[model samples]
Target chain A: MTSPSNSSREAIAHIAFDDLVALLEAIFVKAGTAPGVAAILARNCASAERDGSKSHGLFRVPGYLSTLASGWVDGKAEPVVEDVAAAFVRVDARNGFAQPALAAGTPLLLEKVKACGIALLAVRQSHHFGALWPDVEPFARQGFVALSFVNSFACVVPIGGSKPVYGTNPIAFAAPRAGGDPIVFDQAASALANGDVRIAAREGRSLPPGSGVDRTGAPTTDPKAILDGGALLPFGGYKGAALAMMVEILAAALTGGQFSFEVDWSAHPGAETPKTGQLLIVIDPDAGAGRSFVDRVETLVGRIADAGQERLPGDRRYALRRRAAEIGIPIAPALLKELSALAGAPTD
Target chain B: MTSPSNSSREAIAHIAFDDLVALLEAIFVKAGTAPGVAAILARNCASAERDGSKSHGLFRVPGYLSTLASGWVDGKAEPVVEDVAAAFVRVDARNGFAQPALAAGTPLLLEKVKACGIALLAVRQSHHFGALWPDVEPFARQGFVALSFVNSFACVVPIGGSKPVYGTNPIAFAAPRAGGDPIVFDQAASALANGDVRIAAREGRSLPPGSGVDRTGAPTTDPKAILDGGALLPFGGYKGAALAMMVEILAAALTGGQFSFEVDWSAHPGAETPKTGQLLIVIDPDAGAGRSFVDRVETLVGRIADAGQERLPGDRRYALRRRAAEIGIPIAPALLKELSALAGAPTD
Candidate 1:
C-alpha cells in the first residue's frame, strides 16, 4: 500500500490491514503473549488503526510489550466468568488483557439479556488499554443497546479540588439502527484525553480553554504545565466530574476492583500496565419495544441528519474505517520501522 | 411565615412546609385533579420546595394547573404497570401527571430489582414537569443505585446545529450510603436550563459564557436572546450532545413516546404541559457486592472529601433542605398572592 500524505512533516508509510494485523500478532507473540491472547490483542490494535485512533494503535505496542516482558500482565491467564445472580455476571480477568476477557464474557451477557430484559457484566483484574467502543459496539450490532464504563489510573482532579482522585475514566454507549451501523459514542470524562494532552505537549502546543489546572490550582492552557504536574479538569465543570465519579463507582467499587486512588502508581511508576476494572450493560430493546425499536432509533437519527450540519455520533469513525479498509492504515515511518524490528522483518 | 431578604431585591415571603403542601393540594383539587392524584402532586411540590428547588417547587404549580384546567392531563387516569418482560416494567402513564404514574410503578420495579438484581421502568404517555432527582432518589434511599432520563419539549440545539433538536433532557443518578442521604446528581443536558434562562432574562442578567446561540446561530451570552428566539447549547460541547441523544432514544424511542421535536408545542402553547416519557433503571448493589456496597461508596466519597475544598454531589441540596425544614420555605410575594387566590384563602 502506498502512503498518503497528511499535513504533518513526519515521514509516513501505509500497510495493508492484513499485514498490519500479522505484524502486531507476531510482535505480541515474541513478547511472550499466548497465541490466542496475542491474536485478540492484535485484532484490537488493528481495529484502532482502522478507526484512525493512532495513539492506541501501533503506538501502544511498546508499552504493552514492556508490561508483558516484566511479567506484570499474565499473557496466558484465562478470564473466569460466574453467574452471580439471575441477571448479573462476574468475570475474573485473571490479571489478563481486557480485550480477551470481554470477548469471553460478552456472549454470556448476550444470552442472559435475551432471557431477561437486561444483563450486566462486572469485570475485575483486567488491564484495559484501548477504545471502549470496541468493547460495546458488537452488542449493538447484534441488536442490543449497550453501555460500558472503565476506570484507569488516576489522572484527573475532582472539580474544585487540588489533587487528583479520579481517572480519565471513559464511558461508551451504542444503540442499533435498522439499516445502518449502530449509533456509538465514546468519551473520556476529562476535558481532554491524556493521550491528546501528551501529544500537544510533545508538539509544544497550547490546549483549549478550560482544559486543565496547574499545580498551584490555577487554570492554564499550557499543555506542558498540565502534563508535568497539573491535573486535567473534568469536562463541563461539576457535571462531568460527577459522571467521572459514577464511572469510578460502577467500574471499581461495584465490580470489586481497586479504586483509582488505591492503585499504586508509585510502585510501577514507569513499569507495568494498570490493573483496572470495567462494567458492561446490555439490554434487548426487542424484549419490550419489539420490532419498532430500530425504526424509532432511525427516526431520531434521521431527524439529526436532516438538520443539515449535525452529524450522528460515530459517523466520522465509520467513515474513517471504510477509508482505512480501502487505502490501508497510515502510520508514521519511525513507528513502522520499530514495528518491523519487533516483527523480525526488513523495513521497506 | 415571613420574607427573607435576598440580593436579587425581589419581594419574598415564607410559608410553613405543611401549609405549602395543603395549599398546593387544594389548588390542584380545585383545578379538577383527582383527590388522590392531587395529594401525590402536592407531596412532590412540597418535597421540591423543601429541597430548595424553586424552579420545580411551587413555582411550577401554575403550569400544572393550566394543563389540568385545559384537560391536557387526565386527572382521574390511573397508571397501569405491566411486567412486559422478565425484568422490565412498562407503565402506561395514561396521559396523566408523572408523579402518580411513578408512584404506581415504583413498587413493582423495586420488587423486580430485588429478584433480578436490576430492573427498568419505561413510562409512556406521561407529563413530566419537575426535578428528576425525586423520581430516582427514592430508590437510592432503599439501598439501590438508580438512574433516570426524561425528554421534554425541544428547546436545545444539538452541537454543530442551529435549530433545536433535543430537550433540556434531564438525567439523574443516585447511589445509597450507609448513614446519610444518598449521593445524588440531577442535571439538564443544556448549558443553561430553560428555567434559569427565563429567570436571568426576567432579571436582565447576563448568562455564563457558551450558554446559548442567537436566532442566526451565533453564540451569545444574553439571556434575552437565548430565551426569546434562540436555543440553548448542550453542555460540554459534542460529548454532552451525545448524552442528550441517548436520553431521546431511551425516553422516547424505547418507551414508544413522542420525540421532543415531534411534540406539537403550538397545539397547547401556553395551556398544557408537554407529553413526555421517562426511563428509570435501578440496580441493587447487594445483589452483586453484598454488604460491601455501602462501604465501597463511602470509601470513594471519603477520599473526595479528604481532598479539602471539594464538595460531594448533592451536598448543597441536602444542606438547603435542612435549612428549609428549620426556617420554612421562602416564596415571592406575588407567588404567595397567586397561591392564596387558587386555594380560596384570604390574602393579607
Candidate 2:
C-alpha cells in the first residue's frame, strides 16, 4: 500500500494488522530494542490499535520512544523466568518492558496452570505501557479464566487523601463463553485513565465531574490541571480506593517490585513509563467445572442481555476487531507518516 | 449475665464474647442445626457482633431461623471436600451453610496453598448469609493473602437494566501487615447491602442517591421503595456492574452452583438465604516475597496515612473489636431477651 495522495492526507488510511505490526516492530528496533522484545511489544501495540483501544494504541508510541531514548529502560535486557513453586512463576524483567517479560514466562506459567489447575505469574522491574486486556484475553481463548493487575506511576489519590499514593491501577479479567468471543473487561481504578485525561487535554475538553482535584486539593474538571500539579481521584470513592490499594499489594508488594510511590524517574528526562510490577492469575476452569464452565458463562451472558445491558464489556472491542480484520485498522495519515519516518521508511 | 430490669429494657446490655457465642450456639441448635455446625456459625455470628458489623451480627438470627424452619437449608448436611488437584479444592456443601462448608475444606485448602504457593477453593450448593470478611480474615492471620467472592439472590440491577439479574455480590480481601492487623475489606457490589437497606427501612431513613430504582425503574432514595419489588443499582455505575458480573462467574459458574438469577425459593416461603456458591483464592506470599511481604504492606499503610486518609478499610472494625474485648459486645436488653427466648432459656 502506497501512501494516500496529498489531497487525501487528511483522510483516514487503512493498513493491515500485520503491516502495522511490522511497522511498529521496525520502529522499536530503530529505537534500540532487541528484536525479540520488539516483536512482543509491536504485536501488543498493534492489537490495541486493531481493537480500537485508542488510548493504548498508536497514541502511546511517542511515549514509548521517548522513554527508550531517555535511557530509563533496558530495551535489550532478557527476562529471567523462575519456577518458584508448583503453581508460582516469577519473572525478573531486568528493567525491560513487561510485555516481553510476560511473553518469556508464558510457557512456564501455562505448564504450572495445566498441572496445578491454577498458577500465578509475577513480573517485576518492568514497565507495562499497554492495555491490560490484551494480556489476559488469550488465556480465555484457550479455555481459562485469567486476571491481570498492573500498577503504574502514582497519579491517583486515596479517598479523603490530598496526595497521590496509588497508581491508576487497572484490573483486567477474561473468561471463556460457549458461543461467542470471550468476556473481557479492563478498568482503571481511577475515575479516568491517565491516557484518557491526556487525550482530553489535547482535545481541549473538560473532564467529567469528580474526576480529579487541582494542586490546592479542590475538585476540578480541567484535564490540564489534573495532568499538571493536580491528581486524579479513585472511582466510586472509598471502594475504588480499596481496590487500588489491593492492586498495589498484589502487583507490587507480592511481586517484589517497586511500589507506584517508589517510582522516581526524574533523573531520566522524558521517561514516561513507570518501573513497576505486574501480576497474572490464571485458572484452568476445566479442573473445577469441567465442560460446563463455558456453558455457564453463556447462560450468564444471556441473562445480562435479558436484564437490558445491551453491550457487555468487550463486546465493542470484538466488533471492532472483526471489522478491522475484514478491512484494515484505520490510522490518520499524519500518524502513518510519522511512524514510517520513525521506522526509517520513505514517507512517499 | 442476668436479665435487665423492665426500666432498663430499652437500655443496652453487655455480654462477654464467649457468652454471646454460647448463647448463639444454643439458639442455632434449638433451630435444628448440628451441634458442630452450630458451634462454627455461632462463633462467626458472634465475631461480627464483636466487630461491630451490625448487619451480620445478631440482626441476622431471625432470618437464619426462618430459613431453617422453612426447610430451605440443610442444618445437618455434611460438606464433602474434594482434593481436586495440586492447587484446587472443591466442596459439595450439600445445601448447608457456607461457613461450615468452608470449615470442612480449610485444612485441605491450607495444605494446597502450602505445597503449591497458591490454591483455590470452590464451594457449591451452599448458602452464605453472614459477613464475608470472616471467611478470609483467618487466612490472612495465618500469613497468607486471601480473596473471596460470594453471590447472593438477585436484588441488583445491571447498568441500563430495569430488572435485577445480579446479586449484591460481595468481594472480600485480607492481607497481612507488619505493624498492625491484617488489611481487610468486604464490600457489596450494590450501592448498599441488602441488610443495610433493611436497616434503613426499619429506621425510616432514606437511602443515598444512586442507591436504587423503584418498581417502575425510576431512581428513588426511599428504602421501602427499593425493598418492595424494586432493585438496587451497582455501586460506581457500570464498573461495579462488571465486578458483580465477575463475582457471579467466579463464585457460581466456576463452582457448578446456582447463579443469583437461578435462586428460586418460592417452594419454601420465608427462605431468606440464597443457595449459591463461593470461591476463595489463597496465596502464600512467602513463596514470592518471602518475609518482606508484610514489610511492604506496612510501607503502603504508612503512605496511605501520610496521604491524609485517617482510617483504612478495616481500622474501624479492629478498633471496635479491641473495645469489645476490653468491655463486652454491646446489645439492647430487648434483643437479649429475644435471644434468650430463642435459646429456650428462662427469661426473667
Candidate 3:
C-alpha cells in the first residue's frame, strides 16, 4: 500500500524489542534518570503497544526522553513523599517524569489499601506517563481495586459548551475479585481515543463520524482539521463531558496541579517538557468490608460470566500479557529499529 | 397549552411539600424506620423536589410507602456502622431505604474526612435514593469536596457486548470553594435519564435521535420500544458503559452489595424488590494540599467562567434554591391538595 502522506518514504526500520528497551534506557540514562527508571518506562511503553494502544507507545518514548533532557522534567528527581496518612498521601514529583514518580508512589497506594483499606495519592508536577492500565495493574494483582485519572493541558470542551475548557481527562478503574481477572476499565472521555485520531491523521484517514468537530463547531470527519482548529468531542455527549470535568476536579483540584485552561500538554519544540497532572487511588477488598467484598466481587463476576457472556472485561489483556512473556515482547519492525538506534544495541 | 397526560386529571389533588414530608415520615415510622430514621427519609423527598428533581419527588412517595409496607426493604432496618477507620467506613444499610441510609452514612464520611484528611463511605443493601446532587450538597455545604455514585439494577448493555450487563449508574461530584457555591455534577451514564424516558413514554413523547433503539436491535425514537426490547444506551458509547460499569463495580462490587444485573430497580408490577448500592467519597481541601487545592480549583472555575461563555455547573440550581428559600416552595394545587389530605393539614 502507498504511504498516506504525500511525501512517502519506504525506509521503515526493524529492531528487536529488547534493543528498543535498551535504547529508551540509554536515552533516559543520558537524561539523568536513576539506574532502573528507563527500564520501567520502556516496559510501560511496550505494554501499551502490546495492548493495542498505539498513541501511548514507543511514539511517546522520544517525547518522554526529550522531556527528561530538558530542565522542565528532572529525570533523576525523586518524588517527595510529603504527607502520609492511613489512606491518603501527597507526592511532589519535583518536576520528574511521571513514570518514576508513579512507580515510587504506586506502592504507597497499595500499602494504604492493605493497611487501612483504601488509599489516595495526589501527584503534582510530573510529565505524562504511558497508559494508565499498567499503573493500576499492580493493585489488581494484590486483591485490591484501583482507580486513576489524569489532567493534561486542556484540549477538550466541557459539555454544552463549544470552547475547549478541559483535557480529554482519562479515567481508569480496576476491580479485584477472588475468581477470574479483575475488570480493568481505561478510557478517555472522548468520542475516540485521542491517539486514534492522531494515528488517523498521520495515516491520512478520516476520523470516525462524529468523533471530532472543525473550528467552526461543525462536526467533521477529517482528523487534521479536527486536530488543528477543533476540539475532541466527548463520548456519549454530556455524560462524557461531565466525566471529563470530574476527572479534572479529581486529578487537578485534588493534586494541586495545573488545571483546565491553565495547563499545557503539547511537547515544546526542541525542548523536553511535559504538561499533565494525575491522581491514583486504591481500595483493598479484604479490608473494611472484609471477605464479603471479595466474595461479592467474585459473585458479581460469576453472574456476568454465567449469563453466557463472551469474556470478562479485563480478561483479554491479562491473557495477552501472559502471552507476551511466553513469546517475548511484541514490537513492530519500525519500533524495533527506533529502539535499536536509541540503544545502539545489537539485534537478532 | 394542551395538558400532558400527567395533567389528565382535571381535579388532581394538591399537596404541600411540608405536608407531603410529614406523610412520608408517618409512613416510614409505621413501616419501622423509627422516629429519627423516618424524619431523614422524609427530608430526602423534600430536598429532591427543592433541587428541581421532580422525577425523584412525590411520585416516589407512594412507591416507597408500598416498599415499606411490604417486607422487601426494611423501612425500620437500622443501618449499622460495620467498620470505621481513619478516613473510611463501611455501613450495612440492612436493606433499608437509601435516603436514611445515606443520611446516616454521610456524617460518618465527613467525620472521617476531618480526622484522616479524606473520607469514604460505602453504603450497601440500600433501596433507591433520590438524585445524587442532594446527597452531596450537605457535605459540599460544609466546604468539603464530595463525590457519590449509585448503581441500580442492570438496565443497560455493556458496550460491544451482546447482552445486558450493567446498570444505569448515576454519579455526582460536588466541590466547595471560598468564592462560589458548590460546583455540583449530578449525571447518569445513560443517553437519557431514566425518568425522562419513563415520563416521555407516559406522555407519548418521541425520543431524540441516537438516544435509543427499538427491541429488534434497530434504532427507534419510540420510548416504549427502547424501554421494552432495547436497552438504554450509555452516555459516550463505550466510555459511558465503562463508567456505569465502573460505578457498579465500585458501589456494588466493592461495597459487598448486590450487583446491577442481580437487583431490580423499577417497581413495575410483579418485579422483584429494589436493592441498590452507593459509594461516597469526601476530600478536605485544606488538609494535605493546603489552600492550594482550593486556589487551583477556583482558578480553574474562573478560567471556565471567563472562556467566552459557559456557566459554572450547579450555579443555576444554587440560584434557584436561594430564591425558593427566600420566597417559598411553590406547590401545584393538585399536589398541595394531595399533601394536605394525606397529612390531615388544612391548605392555605
Candidate models: Cα lDDT each? 0.84, 0.93, 0.70
Off by over 4 Å in 3: A1-20, A264-268, A271-273, A288-291, A305-311, A332-334, A346-348, B1-33, B161-163, B213-219, B264-273, B346-348
- DockQ for model 1 equals 0.59
Model 3: per-residue Cα lDDT over A1-348, one tens digit each: 111222334443333445445666776676567766667877777777656566787767777766665556666777877555667788788777676777777766666666666678887787665777877876777777888888766667665455677776778888767766767878787777666888899999997776877776677899997789787877776667667877888887777766756654355444434355688877766545544766777776666555344566667777776665555455545555556566655665
Highest DockQ: which candidate? Answer: 2
Predicted candidate 1 versus true structure: per-residue lDDT over B1-348, tens digit per residue: 455566564757677788888988889888888999999889888888888888898778878877777767788889988887777888888888887888999888888888888888888888888788999888888889898999988788887777888999988999987757899999998898888999999999999988999887789999889877788998999888999999998888888777898877565546556687888888878765533988898998888877544567788889987887887777887777788898888887
If both were scored by lDDT, which would come out higher, candidate 1 or candidate 2? 2
TM-score of predicted structure 2, chain A: 0.97
Candidate 2 ranges with C-alpha deviation above 4 Å: A2-7, B2-9
Q: Give each prediction's DockQ, rounded to 2 decimals.
A: 0.59, 0.79, 0.47
The digit string of per-residue lDDT tens for model 1 on A44-77 reads 8888888877778777887888787776778888
User: For candidate 1, what is the TM-score?
Assistant: 0.94
